[model samples]
Target: MKLLMMAACAGLTLNTAAAQEMSYGHAEYLNSCAVCHGVDGTGDGPLRDLLIRRPADLTQLSERNGGTFPYSRVFATIDGRYAVPSHGNREMPVWGRLFLEDDAKNYGPSGGEVVTTERIHNLAGYIETLQH
Candidate 1:
């Protein structure tokens, strides 16, 4: 029936959209955060031993913050608006300007800041899923 076909098509559309969103976040995580945060979002990245201090176990963020994910803090930290002490000088890079430059290259300067915001927001949303 048309109704059944429509429902199935709608479900596929939603699923495809979800898959794309998850792909963006997962790709971003693997590209940027995994170098320091590890593939599983723990603090056990390959470069962990090279740093001055061990990175925070990302899975514990919600537990440490009393069972709620610190979404804003995570966003700010990703975008360089907030400082996380454990990141240290050698461990963390200020991604805001770098992300802006990236956006400027891809979409021009007019929307660089907005693009950076979206990237950071997506990255934060991805991190939230890592909660224990």
Candidate 2:
């Protein structure tokens, strides 16, 4: 029936959209975080030794931090909110604003904080998947 066919098409379309969004998050992680965190999340990247404080091995984050990944803490760090005085400056760029700026350029005037939050949530979701 046409109704059945339409329902199937809608389901497929939603699945495809989700897949694409996840792919974007994964790609963003590879391009942005892998240089410091390593593709395996082991903190063994080439640039790790050059830094004063070594990059945290992301795979062990939950174990190291009392058996919880502390999603908000991780998010804050990525957004450059947690101050690391020992490092002399922020080790990571603030991605919240960066994502917002990028979205604004692409989505006309309506792109704002909500888009940034969605981007952060997507990236966070991708990071959560990295946990073993």
**Top candidate, metric TM-score:** 1
lDDT of 1 by residue, 35-87 (tens): 87899899888888888888778899999999999998888777885565677
Each candidate's root-mean-square deviation in Å?
A: 6.4, 7.1
Q: Clash number for every model?
A: 0, 0
Error of 2 at 108 (Å): 4.5
Candidate 2 TM-score versus the reference: 0.68
lDDT of 1: 0.83
Give residue 53's error in model 1 in angstroms: 1.6
> Candidates' TM-scores?
0.75, 0.68
Which candidate's lDDT is highest? 1
